[model samples]
Target: MPKVSKHLNAANLIDQVCKCLDEIPDHRPNHCPNGIPFPNFAKSAFAMMHQKYDSLLTFDSDRADPVILHNLATMYHVQDQKVPCDTRMREVLDPIEPAQFRKPFKKLFSLIQRNKLLKAFEYQCGDLKDWYLMPVDGTGLFYSGKCRCQECCVKNKGKPNEAYYHNLLGGCIVHPDQKVVMPFAPEAIVQQDGDNKNDCEQNAIKRYLAHVKREHPHLKLVILLDGLFADNPTIELIKSYGWHFIIVAKDGNHKSLIEAMDALCDQEQLSYHKIIDEEQGTRHWFRFANDVPLNASKLTQNVNVLDYVETDSEGKRHTWCWVTDIELTKDTVEAVMRGGRCRWHIENQTFNTLKNQGYSLEHNYGHGKQHLATNLAYLTFLAFMVDQIQEMASPEFKKALKERARGVRTYLWKVITRVFLSWMLEGWDELFDALIYGIKPGRVQINTS
Candidate 1:
């Protein structure tokens, strides 16, 4: 008998996810040719995503077996698999409503909040306490030559050209100390008829505002962005939504604003800083504008502007600027600076983690006409969230990480991949156990009986 330990239980992560997944609508298509139920495929695809696979179907067929649900349930360590066939899974996903996949984000967030994970990341503005910072950005996902659907936002050139795709603004509350970026509602950037030649990031931000308002109602939001989003209309819309704005104010884009800030700087009342970070081997020069006029367009809202220049040990200077609604005072300046600079957390925590850290976010999952793209994208993010939780909160897994550096720990993934081919334990718990304490050499525990 192969003694398998139940150490790698990623339970809290799964519990939070289940809170969201339970809300997914169970609408089985009556026209599924094979009469296969939809929930089985849904569960299986979700399991494949949790395992960080590029294609759920491929992972089902090639990795474990062609029986989707059985393989998935087994991988999850759940017994009694009612696995569906790959063709049936695809058919079920094709006709499913895209909105069904979204039912979970709100619920999942509620779970996280209830669990007090949200409060773990907190900062202050003036007298304001427990304020959270959310940064918003967009990214493009898929491109294909031969497949284009009504949902396809862009198409490649030539007859069999692949279609181009886009996903709209992903807003998340991020902190520099945190490993995970808690995701909020995302707006999809789709093609519109003659409204604008091409829908843009700012437009997507407009779309995101209502949903953010609906879901978060009273939640304080400080929307951070790049310079392209620092326009008068965008600022006005953000004000209308009753949210604060913290956007990049680049000299190239906000020339008038920069000029105004510079004029204010000459008056000597504005805030400024000159500091050297010996540890980082860099020096910084920073200036800020408090309650400055944004543009000549007569916008009534007030914004705080921050500017910074960095000089490396090699004598290279880099400059950046931003505008925000967060109050600027003697004490809150550093917190706001940290929040402003933490915008890179989305890149490091969300995008790069998905790409390089085993989530296979850019991999070509099933490109169904409707829900597949968004559904898979959500799953990839969910997987990253789970892994992050395990790394941070799971003492067992963290010990595994501590035993080896990140590179070596990643190399161990190859070992799991090989083990997955030859045999199956109960689930990730068993896999972790076997790795930490090797299974008996000749014992086979895959339940071949």
Candidate 2:
């Protein structure tokens, strides 16, 4: 069978993740005793996400089952007999900063890199095979009026509780050719330092960029963002980190940028190129101008503008413009435009999958007084990161994922949901085997009481 690294099998990868959870410093008071191990709460929360359980109540309900307890021990390294209940999970996980979960994302990434699954995300840039296409975007997790927290971003200025919401800045390594996008740790967007000023996506991007850079200093990336991030400060911040960016520059949002492009076109400085297919009845047009000022105010800092238009077989023309620091040529414009357009994958593939698929990211799992909502979001993404890596690297997992009418990812989780809730797994392999080959993976214990 085709394979990834011997260690990339989910069993070992999960062990590493469990270890990372174990290292999350317990925030409970030093004098506290007889409480559940902090890692058990973390692992139990992760298990709930991994199994696509409906809520903390659903996962907590089965904590007493010997089968559920055994599966937690075998699969998630929860040695504690006590799994944290719904309220307990949130209360314990609340004060813990969301950044603590980032190690698991990095751990999974290192393993994926070692296993060479990340090469799929790399695209050729001149003689270098180093550029990983990463798209950064913000998304709404959920909103609540009555369930407000200190970290919730209030949308309206009138009533403090009128429109409380939670948003996250999510970024991931992506390629146009792949369905699976490798996610980095996401940044939560909320009120900062208990301030009344609502945090915006722009501020979150600053924190997101700084944190990702600190975590992965050597990794080369081409960051993609929407029109909101196509600004002087954000671009300058990206450059300070020695990274490249392709940010969408819309006509209304960046009128100065469009004016600059128009001037370049009038001066005949903009290079134009096109690729057409008679067989498919499609046309792709590209225009690029280098060293254009970002805006009237920021004349000193310049960016490259690439305009793209595509005419489909149905004769519908779609167009877009992007500002980037990557040196643009007619030859490189199409590649850069494709990468720029990948910002949508942050919406369609990543966020949409998390919401529509079994991940249940927007579900108000439990919003605590502090970081409960944010920490749960990280665990959901962490589970998603591990699941995506397995989907790509594990032959066994791939087989299980494609079984019967369950080829859809949402369906696989359904199988896992049933297994996790009902099946008495002897080991992790039995679950995989049962999903793939339909053997009796486990049996429910007979009622003797």
Candidate 3:
């Protein structure tokens, strides 16, 4: 483990991100074309994502201000004398493959690892320590009736009513107690060439798993998944990468496996159970069976099955079950349960925050003829990753967040944008101080240089 910094800040992280963006090769042709620099256009798009602007029109309007222009140039490394309009931004960015945008995400992850920020994310299960819990799931980002792009997957509901939508498979490093979840590069669930079959979450997961393994081959990850991924092939794929998994094993899907486990429990062979009483008159019961085959066919591939239920005085019961490659024992059952439950953070913290909490992730920014919608989603997730990093480590960001009365992220974003436009601030620290200490910007010396 590296020595973690106590003062890691977002400004420096953004600056490093800009440097990484600078390294992406400009694939545009050199002939007579629009004069807007690719880096400037890319930076402008990234700025809109970071600010959580709902549309490109608003971002273009804000970019017209000379103060905002100066701030963009100074803060985000946009070099063009003029910001690219929305149309030109789409034109320039659409053709640039979404895979290129993934570089910055990898860069940010590397930075987090180097700074030892991942130490706080390390999850343990008895003898297992320092395992990063990566939860993978899929969600719909865009849906329209009339608008259908080449990338949109078509869903026909028997008649004239058809739906075209874009779905993505997203994974993030998550922890049960941690409020922030760091997202990885998402894989789009879109139509592919020469294939009549529509792309689904399972296919996307295969691609995403390959991508993750190719990108970070050495990182120790325990794959957390929902019931959809509790199958033989997916488990084999995970095992092939030398990774561990804790996947939801629902009764409806794994009936045979459940029956076999129940038989073992009835015989009290390879089965264990524990009961605990809480102060609030709640009784918690845990049961687990080891070396259970996943199905009738894959009898050689065994998994450890674990389940828990809590019954209150009112007779209400809450139950959960999971299957994992990890060995099931009395000492490790609770830790495994915690790891399994942390999968919700990917949906609640990452997806829900992006959708409802001011990121406007579901809003249609632009559906270009090519990869615009997917690229915009990628950029939005990148912005969310930066914010999560700041929340986890930066004291200045935490202080500014505390100063807000409502404590809503959207309001905080509005406050930051207001301060950026109204005040002659030079860096993030000065802007944060203005928000935190209520210091008038007029009193501070403005450093335009």
The candidate maximizing lDDT is: 2
List TM-score per model, in order.
0.83, 0.94, 0.91
Which 10 residues in a row give candidate 2 its minimum summed lDDT?
Answer: 191-200
Q: Name the candidate, 1 or 2, with the larger TM-score value.
A: 2
Best by TM-score: 2
> Cα lDDT of model 3 overall?
0.82
What is the per-residue lDDT of model 1 for residues 1-449, given as tens digits with 9 covering 90 to 100? 11112221365456445555555555663644455344556656666666656665666576335333343555543335555556666656665665565555665566556556667566566766877778887776666655555555764434465456645557778776776578764566665421332345667677777777887788777777877778777788878877777788777777778788868868776887777799999997777768887765575556788877879999899877778887776566666777787788777777776778776767777667766666667666666655554554455565555553353545555555555555556555666666666667786446675
A best-first ranking of the candidates according to their lDDT comes to 2, 3, 1
| TM-score, cand. 2 | 0.94
lDDT of each: 0.64, 0.83, 0.82
Give the per-residue lDDT digits (tens) of candidate 3, residues 322-347: 99999988888888888998899888
Model 3, position 399: C-alpha lDDT score: 69
State the lDDT of candidate 2 residue by residue for 47-148, as single tens digits: 888887767887777889887998888888887677877887888989998889899999988888777787778866554367888899988998876788
